[model samples]
Target chain A: MAKVPVQFTLNGSEKAEFIDSGTTLLHALRDKIGDTSPKGGCHQGTCGACSVIVDGELRLSCLTLAETCNGATITTTSGLAEGGVLHPLQRAFLDTFATQCGFCTPGMIMAAKVLLDHTPNPSREDVVEALSGNICRCTGYEPIIQAVLTAARGNSQNAA
Target chain B: MAIRRGRGVAAINYPTGMNLGGDPTQALVHSTPTGNFMVTLSSVDLGQGMKQIMAQICAETIGVPTDCVVVDTADTDTGPHCMGTFASRGTHRAGNAVIQAAKEARQVMLEVAAEELEVNASDLETDGQGNILVKGAPQKSISIFDVALSAHFKRGRSISGRGMFLIPRSYPEKETGAMKPSTCYAHACTVAEVEVDDETGEVTVLTVKNVFEIGRALNPKMVEQQLVGGSWMGISHALYETTEPYYPNRDHGGTDFNQYLMPGPGDLAETEIIVLERPSADGPYGAKGPGEMCANPQIPAVANAVFDAVGVRVDTLPITPERILRALKAQAN
Candidate 1:
C-alpha cells in the first residue's frame, strides 16, 4: 500500500505522519506519535476506549481514519495537563477515586470533557447519557458519574 | 400485561483462599540506605489495589509511614514465589507474608536504633513517623534515616527480611470425605428487587442492597470500590452476560463485545452496601479476602427475585428474556 501523507495539530503542536490508506487515528497517535494514553479496549467502536476530540467534537479514534483528519485539531488525555496543573476533570477523577484498572479512564475523561464543554452544569441523568458509550468494568459507573458532576460544580464555582 | 414487582434475599459464606495443595504466597522486605522500604513480590495487582494494600500492610508492620514503602510486584526473576492471584487469597495470604517480612526488617531497624541510642533493643519503639526512640524517653530518639545510614556505612549491616505464608493442605477422610478446607470464611447477604413484565418477559433490576462481613477492611475505600463494582458484575452475570447463549449445542457463540452482551451504564441499579468487620484469627490484621465473594450473593438474590416477580424458576446461567418467556409459557400450559 502507498503511504499517504497527513498533517494535523495534536495537543497544540503540529505533527506530520505517513500512514496507509486504512490506518486509524488511534494507530497514528500511538504508533507514530507515541502518545499512548488512549487505550484500545476494542477495535470496534462499542467500547469507546479510544475516544478523542476532533475539532471540538468527540470522535472514536479507532473508527476515524488518520488521513481524514489531515488538517483537523485533536485533543486527548495527554493534553489535559498544562504547566504541572491537571484539568478539573482529572483532578476530580483522582479525588473521587473514579478509576480502578484505569483502562477506560482516558476515554471517560474525554467524553466528560465534551459533555462539560457543551453543558457547563449537567444533571446526574445528563452525565449518564453523555457517558453511556464508554464501558468501565471496574467502577460500576458510580464514581465516574460523580467525578463529572464534581468537575462541573468546580468549573461553575471557578466561573463564579 | 402488567409489571410485577418483587424482592428476594440471599446469604452466603465464602472461604478465604483455596485449600487445594496448600496455597502459598511470599514477600521480601528490605530497607534502602535512605530509610525507605521496598517490598518485592511475584503476585500481580490486577488493578485491585494489591500494591497499595501491601504497602499499607508493610508500613503498619514496620511502624513506618505508608509513603516510605514501595511495593514492587510480578517480577519473576527478582521477586519471590507466589501462587498467583486467585481464590481471593491475595490479601489474606500475601498480606500475612508481607507482615512477617516487615516484622523481621523492623526488628533489625530497631536494633540499629538501639545501638545508636545506647539502649537495649527491647526498650526501643518506633514512632511510626520515621523515628525510633527509647521507651518513655522523649529526648532519646534517632531518625530512621540516620539509623539506616549508620547500619550501611558505620556498622556494615544489610537490613533485609524474607517471609512466606502457606496454608497446610488437609486430605479428605476416606469414610465421610470431611476435611477443613479453608482457614477463614467471609460472609455476605444481598437483597435484590426486580420488576418483571408478565407479557414481554423483560426483567429490570430496581435495587441491590447488600451487607458484607469481611475479617477487616485494611483500606475501606478500596473495599467499597470492590463491593460496588463486583455487585454490578453480579447483576450483569445474572441477566445480561453469556458467551454461549444457546448452550449444549455450540453453533451460535458470541465472538466480540457486541455479541457477548453486558449491562450498559443505563442499565445500572441503585446499590447500597453495608460492611461489617469480624476479624479472623489467621488473617493479616484480622483481614479476610473480599475479592470474589462480593459478587456471589447477588447472583442468587437476583435469581430468587426473578422467581418472586414472575413466579417462574429459570435455573440457567443468565435468566434471559427468552428463558423467562419459555418458563412463563410452560407455567401457562
Candidate 2:
C-alpha cells in the first residue's frame, strides 16, 4: 500500500497530511486532524452521523476517500461556532431539547446547517425530507424537526 | 385501496431501582472552601441527564443554586459506589443518596454559620444564594464561603457528608413467585392509533396518546425524551424491526441499520402526553422511574391497534405485511 499526500482546508485552517490511500475522510478528520465531532455511526453511509461539508456540499465522510478530499474546503460541527458562540442550529437544538444522548448531534446539526444554507426557511415536510438520512434514536424526530423550523424562524427574524 | 383506522390502549408498570439483594448506592458530598459543593457519584450519565437531575436535587436540598453544585460522576476508581446507571434507577437510587448527603452537609454549614453569627443553628435559614440569615433580621447574615472556610481551618470540621441507600431483599413467595423487586413502581397507559391497508396488509401507526403517572418528572424534558423515544422503539418492535425472522436459528439477526428496519423521521407519529405527578413515598423528591416503562406499554397497545384496524390478531414480532395479509386471508376464508 502506498501512502498518499492530501491537503485540505478544515475548520478554516489549511492542513496537510500523508495517509494510506485506503483511509476514508472520516478517519483522516478524526485521526489526523483530531476533530472528533463528526461521529462514526453506520459506516455504510446510511446513518448520517459522519456527515460533513465538502466544498459547500453535504458529503458522507465515511464514504469519501481521503485522496479525493485534496484541496477541498471541509466544515464540521466543530467549526459551526465562532469564539464559543453557538451556531443557530446548536442554539435551536438546545432550546427545543432536540438532542438526547448527544451521539447524533454533530451530524444532525451539520445536516440542519446545509438545509438552512439552501432553503433558509424550510417547511416541516422540507425539514423532514432534508433530515431523512440522519437517524436520531432518542428524540423521535419531533424535537429535531421543531428545532430546525425554529432556527429558520430565528433566521428570518434576524433578517427582519 | 381503502385504509381503515382503529385505536387500542394498553397500560403497563415498571419497577424503579434494582433491589435483588441489598442493592446499595452511595454518595460522597463535600463543601469546598470557595462555597462550591462537590458530589461524587459513580453513576454514569449515559446521555440520560442523570448528572443534571442529581445536581439539581443536591442543590435544592443544600439550599443553593444548581450551578454551585458540581456533580462529579467520576469512574469507579475515583467516585463512590453505584451499581452503574441502568434499570431506570439513577434518579430514584442515586438521587436519594445525594439528598441525604446534601442535608448532612447543609447541617454542618448552618452550624458553622450559627457560631459565626452568635445565633442558634435552628434560627438561621439559607437564602438559597449561599447566604445564611437570621429569620427575622435580614441584615444579619453570613455567607457560606465564610462558614466553609471556618469549618475547614478553625473548627476542625471538613464539611463533608456520606450517604448510602439500600433496598433489603424481599423473599419470593413460594407458590406465587412474586417478590418486591424495587423500591417503587412507575405506571404508564398508552393508546395507539393505526391505519391498516386490507389489500397490502400494511399498518401505519398514526398517533400515540399517553398518560404517565411518573411520580415526579425531575426534569420534564428528559422524561419527555424517554416517552417519545420509547414510543418509537415500541412502534419499531411492533411493525418494523425483528431479529429472529427465522425462528430457532440464532445464527444472526439483521446485520446493519438498513436490514434492521428502524423507524426513521418519515415514520414519526404525532404524540400527545399527559404527565401526572403522583410522587412516590420513598423516592427522592418523590420522583419515580419513567425511563423504561414508556417502551413496555406501547408494545401491547400497537398489537391491539393492529387487531382493531383489521379484526385480526398477529401475535408475532415486527408484524410484517405478510403476517397481516395471511391473517386477513384466513379471516376472509
Candidate 3:
C-alpha cells in the first residue's frame, strides 16, 4: 500500500500528514497527530466511542478513512475543553458522577454534546437516542441523563 | 436482626448483631499510639459508595473533616489486608480499622495532655473538638495536634496508630440449619411494575420501588446515584443487554457493540430508590454495600414483573423479544 500525504485541521490547527493507504482516520488522529481522545473501541461503526464532529455533523472516526478526511476540519474529545478548563458536559459528568471507568467518557460526551448542539434542551428520549451507540458498563443511564440535563441547564444559563 | 423465613432461616445468622457506640469522635484523634487501619475491600465499585463511607468512618472516629480522611482500596501493600470490595464490607471493616487507629492516637495524646495539665491521665477528658480538658478546670486545655507534636519533639517517639478488623469466623448455626454465612447482610426488597407488548414481547419497565437496609447512608446523593445507576444496569441485563461471542474473523457471526444491545432512554420509565437506615453492628457509620447487590436481583425482578404483566416466565437471562414470543406461544399452546 502506498503512503499518501494528507492535510487536515485538527483541534483548530492545520496539520499535514502522510499515512499508509489502509490507515483509518482514528489512527491518523491518534498515532500520527498525537491525539488519543477518540478511542478505538470497535473498529466497526457499532460502538460510538470513536464519534467525532466533522463539519458540524457527528461521525464515527473509526469508520472514516484517512483518505476521505483530507482537508477536513475535525473536532475530538480533546478539543472539547478550552484553556485548561473542562467542557460543560465534562463538569456535568463529574458533578452527576456520570463517569466510572472513564473509558467511554470521550465518546459518550461527544455524542451528548452533538445532540445538545442541535437541540439545546433535549428530553431524556433525545439524549438516549444520541448516546445509544456509546456503551458504558458502570453507570446505568440515569446519571448520564442527569449529566445531560445539567449540561442543558448550563447551556441555557450561558445563553441567558 | 435475622431475616426469618417460613419456620426456618434463609441463612443461619442472616442479620448479624449491631454495634452501639456513643459519639466517640474525640478519642480517636486525641489518643496516642496510632494503630494500623486494616480493611478488606473488593476492587470493583458496585456503586455502594464504600470509598466515601470509609472516609466518613475515619473522619468521625478521628475528629477530622470528611475531606481530610482518605479512603484506600484493597491493594496488598497499601497498609493492612482487606477482602476485595464485595458483600458491603467497606464501612464495617475499614471503619473499625480507622476507629482503632484513632483510638491509639488518642491514648497517646491523652497521656501527654495528662502530663502537661498535671492531672491523672484517666481523669482528663478529651473534648469533641480534639482538645484535652482538665476536669473542673475549663481554662486548662491542650489541642490534640499540639500534644502529638510535643510528644514527638520532647519524647523523641513517633506518635502513630493502627487498626485491623477481621471478618468474624463462625460456623452456620447448627440448630437453624441455615446457610447464614455472610459476614453481615443488608436486606432489600424491590417491586417493579412493567408493561409488556402482547404482540412484540417488548417490555417497558414502568416503575421500580426498592427499600434496602444499608446499615447507614454516609452520603445520600452518592447513594441515590449508585442505586439509580445500578438499577439501570440490572434492567438492561434483564431486558436488553447481552454479551455475544467476540470473533476475530469478520465473516464469523459475532457480538460487538452493534448487535449486543443494552437499554437506553426509551426503555425505562420511573426509577425510585429508598434507602433503609438500619445501622449494622459491624459497619462503620452503619452502611452496607449497595452497588452490586442490587444488580444481581434486577434480571429476576424484571422477569417476575413480565410474568405479572403477561403471565410468561423467562428462565434465561435477557428475556429478549424473541424469547418472550416463544414463551407466549408455548403458554398459548
Off by over 4 Å in 2: B175-178
Could you tell which candidate, 1 or 3, scores higher by DockQ? 1
Q: What lDDT does each candidate get?
A: 0.92, 0.88, 0.68
| DockQ, all candidates in order | 0.76, 0.76, 0.40
lDDT for B64 (candidate 2): 88
Model 1 agreement with the true structure over A49-102: per-residue lDDT tens digits: 999999999999999999999899999999999999999999999888889889
Ranked candidates (lDDT, high to low)? 1, 2, 3
Report lDDT (Cα) of residue B79, candidate 2. Answer: 81
Q: lDDT of candidate 3 vs native? A: 0.68
- Badly placed stretches (over 4 Å) of model 1 are none
User: In model 3, what lDDT does residue B48 have?
Assistant: 53
Alpha-carbon RMSD to native, per candidate: 1.0, 1.6, 7.6
Question: What's chain A's TM-score in each predicted model?
Answer: 0.99, 0.98, 0.95
Q: Candidate 3 chain B: worst 10 consecutive residues by lDDT?
A: B3-12
Return the candidate ranking by DockQ, descending.
1, 2, 3
Fnat for candidate 3 (0 to 1) = 0.46
Candidate 2 to truth, TM: 0.96
For candidate 1, write residues B65-134 as lDDT tens digits: 9999999995777779999888889999999999999989999988888888898999988899999888
lDDT value, residue A107 of candidate 1 = 98
Residues B1-333 of candidate 2 have per-residue lDDT tens digits of: 579898999998889877766777899899998789999999888887888998899999989899999989867887889988888888888999999999999998888888899999999998998898999997999998888989888887878788898877888999999988776999989999999998998888989998888998888988887787777777878888787776678665788888878888888878888899999999999999888777777778988998998899988787888898999889889
